[model samples]
Target: MLLDKDGILQDVIPPRPPLQSLDSLPGSLAQKVYASLKQAILSLAFRPGERMRKSEICEELGVSRSPVTEAMTRLASEGLVDIVPQAGTYVTRFSMAEIHEGAFLREALELAAIETVATSITEEQLVLLRRNLRIQEALVRDEDIAGFYEMDAQMHELILSFTGYRRLAFLAETSWVHVNRARRLNLPSPGRMQATLAEHKAIIAALEARDPHAAREATRHHLRQLIKFLEPLVHERPELFANH
Candidate 1:
């Protein structure tokens, strides 16, 4: 096998990368760095309230300071981090109110989209969704946390795509980054993982049946599960989140 100068495998049937809403991002230094860092944060690679040092990040990512700075700034603007004067940047903390707001907003918007697509879902879209669900189930069964999370993100994206609203999909994705950190925290529990998989199955069934109310209810139910999980975290660990 051919090897690059760094001596790592150039090609070894590269493993499929985990899923995230940022997967379809455009090509650019800023976008690349942003997606990378966003995924890291969502996957809990960077802990909540953890300080982010620009110099260290620059070296670690093998990129210049500008792109990393730009990425961090964008993340900060998204409420994923706090940049303070005379203090330093820190990963944003989780807040119960914000979590509730995110769930309510996502439920409203996504339910509307699901309703719109209930009758309009094409055969191809349904097929792809089935494939995604299969992958999601397999990942969950294997306890492949990263793969499960990725499939979950993609399933949401797929539903939005079927609604034929790129702008809505983009907005939905931006909203996901906030919830993702919380999800990463909550998902390690076996009970939570099992419930999540069950919820996904319920959603898939509702969508397949082309039942608008059922689809909407399924979506709302899943998000409510997250609310239950995050409320305690918010109360138990105020240090992990900013002012709510």
Candidate 2:
């Protein structure tokens, strides 16, 4: 893997094989299996550090052993789950250090992406971004945490996508797969979520004015907010990091 200056993966010389790509139409057994497991892990239905039995997963998901195996393999590759030899598979546990590192790395990449995008973002792109922010604000007010999170992900993805850095976007996305649960929890906190929307408004203002420096700062501030939001949880539940 080639890393960028910000320490994000830029490219994989021998790219990892693609996992099951289920569409809105219909999906293969493996794809369906992967989707189900991914959701359960994200929603905390399969709690952190919980052991996962292949047989149990197969029975619960109503799939065969092969699809469960494939899903577990894919989730393991993404760092969402772990496969311990001879013991059992387990959902990856949260760690204070890993959480901080992820937030820091994401901060750097997003700041860079914002700066890059601000320099070239068009009026049309600005319109679309503002529209996203509006929807996000409404969703946040409705306490629609999940919907707001999806829009938040889309907002960041849009910035990277429009900036013409698909490789960097791909790397950032993979990293997000590991930390999305924490990110989702961050949005439900009152003060943190309010600050998030304010930051989004500031970012939009900077982008609209074509101020690259302000846009970068806004992005950095937004990402750093997660560190403070998650601090209490990690401190109270120190056991979460024992295995890490």
Candidate 3:
């Protein structure tokens, strides 16, 4: 059962859908399982700290224990799961420290990326960015919060891609796994989505103008918004967070 902010028992989490066949998927069985489980965890289908039973996962995915074990180990390494000896595996609880560290790294890498691309960004890239923004606007109008969040990530990634640094893009993707959880939790807040769209526009504008300083400031400002929005949530939903 899930617990509310007042620590009362709320509705139980429903069973997740069985994993589909991997025939058309691009990866190995283990990789596909890992991706599906990670998406479920990040999407909050598996609540924070909820136990993840291997037998159940094996049954759900129609796979053997080998691939499930491999997926769990990878998730554990990504800080998204905890495997305790003789106890069980569970979804990792939220950690403010980890979130902040992710934010810090994201700011550093993205700021550098934006600076590097400021003067050298091509028109095609600019068009791609604008197209992304237009899609985000439509998503916002439709109140498709989840779609908007995905697009938001894509927008930042487009900026980072201009740097031609594959490692930097990889780091940004990794760091966002932690930060994205916080954003998902806080997404229901009113006006947060609109605010994010405005912020993205600001950053894009600065980059288009070739003003690295403005772009850096805008990027820093956008990254910090998540922390500010999370302060009250951390207090209200203490059960969702870890002491670390």
Candidate 4:
């Protein structure tokens, strides 16, 4: 806790997202099961390294053994779960090595997207982006870290959408499955959520100026901040990491 303007000490705890219902989820049975598990895992509702009881999940989602089996297989492929033959299914633990690799790949893709959008973005797109930023700012104020996180993903996907490359967003999401889950740890750090908003604004400012170099720089700087913010977790919260 830090002193406020009036010198009063205050408690500062970050709120976690609640677990979402698995009922009535849309898609094919397997697809719906996959989406539900993915969201829970990504939001840290299913804690990293915690055992996944397939029977419990099947009963909760009202799904059969086959759909649950298919979802577990797919999640394992995505690095979201580990299937231990004798032990149990478990949420994958954070690995700094994997996170670094994911960051490198994302930076390469986003820099290219930034340059593309800087030149080609239309006014309608800017309006959508600005609206997103407004919501991000409010989330930061509310200290609604989970809400802000979803908005953050939306803004990135929106920028990629502006590039008119239909497959780029899918590529980015699929490629960084581990990094996406690990990012849940970084945002709630002291001042990090607000700092993210500021960085996002800088990117938008550069985009509005129609300056590719500046926009690319903004995107690079924003992506690099992830590692900086996450570095402390390796030492401070060792249980969050694999092989700790």
Candidate 5:
């Protein structure tokens, strides 16, 4: 990893990592294609509004157009891509309206989950959360924003898991597709990753203290920060967003 004069990691993450190997992936051909494409899109490998040429994808995957189109169709259905009639397909852009709705849904689910967890979290679960935070701190120091994001997500899921409701995590994740894509775009901002780490620590502390009120407040603030961070991006990067 290269570092600048201040010893900060420079360009640590690529614009996109290499494409996923389909043969190594589990599932049917179409499913594998869909999974690969979705991973690329969510990870920002395929940026918003970027054209996805069928021929290029076919060449890259060494597959026919059928499966690629099939995968794209699936992505479009999920609002991850747009399928134009004659103009070829492009990744879906962000809109604050959609982002806010997704945030609202997530906060509603997570506030309740954290409240339940605060009252019932065991020592073992608390230890797991602390351990997760340690890794997140390390990732931040290393400037591994992608790794830190994964750990950040795990911390949330761990809280939901502690709630003893098997489906809440799935419900929160599946319902927040738009938010997830937009949320990641904000992580690379200077000092933002460290700020987020502090927020997570506050949440874990509230959980450790078994204070449901504190937990709810902490969770709410943490979730809202993503929206706050994203607000400026809409104007700065107008091409990456749309009213729809």
Candidate 6:
């Protein structure tokens, strides 16, 4: 099932093909199934709070019940799904508390990362950042919201990578799952893409100037924008959010 941008309930749609090629993905059958399902949920193709039946999923993916059940269990552990006895499994609703928590963690880690790398960023790395911004500008012009969003994430990861702390990137990536869901739900808001491009340019400018404090501030501001965007959404689409 899916929910339209207006929060109206929509007819059920079969799961799209896995975002990544299954043959190229490195995982057992259960793990591959889990990855595919995770992407579906994150992309909102599965829809928040929609029930996920094992039989239906198996039929859609041409898989068996065991892999689908295992995948659902894994998703539940990641707080992406809830399994209720006798009630079946469901995609988890958005949680304001979780979103805030994720933002807090992401801000702290990313700030530290930028501060650490600001003074030492090599010219070569700066070139790559510039190239990314160029592509982002084109994406904005084309109104490729999904592509722009993906590049936004990659740019952050690139910044974090400069710190040489793989764990920092890993932590940021994990926290991003929650944030990305919220962003995707609230996407295509008027002028949001342009504003995002401007914000990203500011962060890059700070990096170019080798100003850690400025970069940290820009990154924080960028991350917080999502929270502001979501606050009104929670009120307008209460059905999409959890009670707690």
Better of 4 and 5 by TM-score: 5
- lDDT of each residue in 35-146, candidate 1, tens digit only: 8888777766676777888887777666798988899899888998889999988888787667767766777779899888887888789999899989988887787877
Candidate models: Cα lDDT each: 0.76, 0.74, 0.84, 0.84, 0.86, 0.84
Count clashes in each candidate, considering only residues at least 3 apart in sequence or on different chains.
2, 0, 0, 0, 0, 0
| Lowest-sum lDDT 10-residue window in model 3 | 1-10
Clashes of 4: 0
What's the ranking of the predictions by TM-score, best on top?
5, 6, 3, 4, 1, 2
Q: After TM-score superposition, what is the CA distance of residue 207 in candidate 6 from its true location, in Å? A: 0.4
In the range 136-234, model 4's lDDT, one tens digit per residue, is: 999988988879999999999999999989999998887677788877777756777878999999999999999999999999999898888677768
Between candidates 3 and 4, name the one with more favorable lDDT. Answer: 4
* RMSD, every candidate, angstroms: 8.8, 10.0, 3.3, 4.2, 3.5, 2.9
Candidate 2 has a TM-score of 0.82
Q: For each candidate, give its TM-score against the true structure.
A: 0.84, 0.82, 0.90, 0.89, 0.91, 0.91
Q: Which candidate is the best by lDDT?
A: 5
User: How many steric clashes does model 3 contain?
Assistant: 0
- The CA lDDT at 200 in model 6 is 94
Residue 153 in model 6: shift from native, Å? 0.8
Clashing pairs in 4: none
For candidate 6, the 10 contiguous residues with the lowest summed lDDT are 1-10
Error of model 5, residue 194, in angstroms: 0.5
The reply for model 4, stretches above 4 Å from the true place, is 1-19
Q: Output the lDDT of residue 102, model 4.
A: 90
Give the alpha carbon lDDT tens digit for every residue of 184-223 in model 5: 6778767788899999999999988999999899889999
